[model samples]
Target: MDHTPLRIAIIGGGVSGLSLAYYLQKFGSEAARQIEITLFERKSSLGGNAETVWVDLGNRRLPGKPGTPYRRWADLGVNDVNLATSPHLRTLLAEIGELERLKPLENTASYFSRDGSVALTDDRELFRGASDPSHELSLADGGRLAVLIALLHRSAIDLVESRRITPRYTVDDFFDACAAAPAEMLSAAANALNVDIDWEDPALPERLERLRHTVYYPRISAMYFTDDRGPGGMPLQAPFEYYRLQEGGSPPDRRYFEHGVQHWLEALAAHITGPLKQGPRVEILRGIEVEARLSTQGVTLTERAPGERRWEADLLIMATHAEDALPLLTFGDGLSETQRELQHILGKVRYTRSFGVCHTSATRLPPNPNLWRTRNIEIRGREDTFHPYRIDYVVNRHQNDAETPCYDRAGLPQFFVSLVDDLNRIPRSEMLDRHASPPDAPASLAGAALGAAGYRDRLPAIESALEAKAWTLFKHNVLDAECLEAQAEIERYNQRTARRRYEGHRGVCPLLFAGGWTRGAGLQEQCLKQSAHLVALLLAAPERRLNPLRLAASGGQARQRHSQASGFAPLPASL
Candidate 1:
């Protein structure tokens, strides 16, 4: 084996690993030279949870002889890619020429409750589309909500008075403020937190008040669907705030390959392993157990892939979720006491499970341009229920043509609904052994009195309901079970414990963990930024022995270009 060339092995070919590979190939000098890179994925395909399915319109022949085939992407996990985390994602999209295919789901409607009521949550719709006078508000409700919002904003401002703002406030404290303050006041506080509120006038207090009323408060409790129980639940604060802040725009001006995200990822993999000379899907070891070790070469990974074969890597870049990574790492393995202590702290990170139901049919819903729905009912033991949180539905507009309103496509409504659930209360053991478990582990009956903080007591019921409903809906449409499971695994990996383990090997390992799980920020943009930062660090490493002449020449050119552009004269040739 050639020791002169650096051998890099990236475990888990998910978004994080793939993005890192992309950046490394584009930026690393020796990436094509001395650097030997190999990406290992347990699954046959890449893209991890970013999987898409194609629904055959021809199969469900409608009134029209042959309908066009359209591809449906399962955002089984992530839907909204926040722009704040990584601007490079936009650049990546542009480079791939698929930026135009990126369409922002219409931000018009949100589910207020499980009963399927729609609310105009978007600012444009709230201001112009509100039909009911009460929903629109008559100066009085707006005024009251406004006054409350102002006070809440003032309190938040006071909390950070003269000090750096930090995410130090507990979720309880934040919810208490919302619950105690007037609806309008809560709205104002929401606006301060980046919730968009549309006001016609720039300065009028009344207009401002109307905007405040539109600020949907976060449900402090857990949320569940009365119609169908599920394995997953979500925090009221995250989804509510997310929906309230979600913005939309026309589709990007690029073309999607039409196959799905998997297709694109396959193309990326080909570019890396084929043209880039990196090994592609070298080997997939399914039930391989991993444990941490240390040697003179630095941190070592003891991996038992499928069979009796055991392998070791000088540096292992784990792109798996935190939960999956947890079983691979141990605190006793050459870890410092401080590292062990930090692991304890990181283990506290938690996760919530969520489910999605995608429906495609020959008929469509009414042509309500701004159709939206938000969760309304607040389930006991689960507080966070309502708009921008828990579950959301999206109706694709591009499928409909000029004569047909987006919602009125041959009377067939194709909608995707997401249902969020809590998993903290439910034990993993119970889930794996639901049949053999005790009576307490069984599903709860409908309308059963679920005591406060009794999520464990209610797990079986929720899980049962989720399975039944999911299967029923999925049977009618195409199902993406593997993608859904991958998404769940990703969520489990985001827990605090997983974070501690990864952070523990921070400086010691050449393998850097950069992903949504590592940072607990699951947005695509964040992943891109982390990838770029990691690539830059790897490229600048002095130990790599990159040519100094190349560096100086590049620097000289940069200076020359800067001087010429700034209209400065060349440096004098003085001795």
Candidate 2:
């Protein structure tokens, strides 16, 4: 066989694949001249899950045209873009000259039950205000809660450094410690903190047990924080603090996307597809089936276009979401045993169910507002529909216009509420029966119920309720579920084996594994760091790559310092 330039096919066109393409073009060596790269997308446009759509409001018109309607671009999913998850994304944006576009979302404010109505719950104020006596806490109980907080704070600090915390901690630890403390102190602490812990309630033990088994242990195992308190009421405590300490400060303003993230992504795609002229010249074959085979020559991919033409490539990189790409690969000569095994491991990578309702031409809410929380509503047979958690409205914080909120100015506010149920654990049949089908009609229920009850009624209640002029319901899976430990181990094994398999070909495959699932743990910062690691792997592969830990330990200077510090000096050249 002729030793020719390598042909590379990037299977998914999401951010990961695009990022890889951008860097491969920017950094590949002169030897990379032989590399031919093609990026394939099942969808006509790139961005994959990151796509956004503009909803037109017939009643609302822009200033110049009375009859012309206005539209607001609704980010169908991924409302928050964490700077900490992946520096590669940040670097990619910077290379494209769009890093300035990164922005931060407002600090979250929650609402909880108060006097049979909802009241504001600010985490900062809640922690700060705990010292005040009027808040009420018995000395003993207060001491215990204080001790718990201190331990948690310490644990959080440790997690920041090592990214590993023991999964053995349970709800019993929380309750037992409180129970063992002085009764008066516990009572006072409860009163002072205004925490609603009903010790005498018959369901207390069972609730605590449920929390231990389902929430606390699982979250600890997954290495992500849970709310445990606040409106969403997750089992783990101090979520925002965990992120702040680990990732180092809040992300760029999320609402700063002037034209929307899709705009930036499109701009990025245009630059890569048009100018950089990188590796494996991309031949986009829309509406074609991709087939992968282990040919005698090497791995060959045959793309069959609509009219029955075949296109082949030496190597294929699957960058689409695992769920979507898994099916595509399975259709061909079955995935290698190793790949099939990896898929099974990936199966344990759970996702949370999320439902978004978009309302257009509706009365906008105040900037950085908190929607009210209702009593833990149970969906009969569904354990606790509200059990794991839910989020009200992630309002646009970058909305600067006092009169017109959000950039598009469709005269409506963009609010996203998540249903937050464990997608993996739920039976498929039950999920289909419960949520697969859309409601008979799109009701303005969420906006009306959460808004009016939360006391945003500067306008008449009836008017506020009627403000929801038009709406749409979207159901998708949030990549925020816990991966069981057994599955994580399998993934680790598969990754090692896959890396070894590619090494025999002389050229290491540029295919990289990423996403929330592959991040070891699901913290946003972990995802960001993984992105950096992927970039490093791509840069140093088949030659100078450093071990994962050493790279992480030395930060970006691992290669430079490792050689010098190890005392394995290179011999001088003879004259």
Best by TM-score: 2
Q: How do the residues 123-148 of candidate 1 rate in per-residue lDDT, one tens digit apiece? A: 22222234443322122254443343
Off by over 4 Å in 1: 1-3, 30-33, 55-73, 82-86, 114-120, 123-166, 171-264, 276-294, 298-312, 330-342, 359-389, 397-411, 422-511, 541-575
The superposed Cα distance between candidate 2 and the true structure at residue 463, in angstroms, equals 29
Please name the candidate that would achieve the greatest lDDT relative to the true structure.
2
Model 2 worst lDDT run, 10 consecutive residues: 566-575
Clashes of 1: 49
Q: 1-575 in candidate 2: lDDT tens per residue? A: 33676666767565556655654555444332366667766545455444343444345656787764443444433444545433445556677777775554343333222232322222221221122232211122333333333223333333323434333333334445433442332444334334455566555444433333422233332222222222122222233233332223222122335444455656666667775565435444433456555432445565655554444666555654455445555323333554666566656554433333333211122222233111111111213333343333433332222323444345444433223332222222222111111132112111111111111122244333333322212222222223435325644663563465445544333234554445433333344444444444444444344343233434423321222222111110000
RMSD per model, one decimal: 14.5, 13.4
TM-score of 2: 0.60
Candidate 2: stretches off by over 4 Å: 1-3, 30-33, 57-68, 84-86, 113-118, 123-154, 157-247, 250-256, 276-291, 294-297, 300-309, 330-336, 360-389, 394-512, 520-575
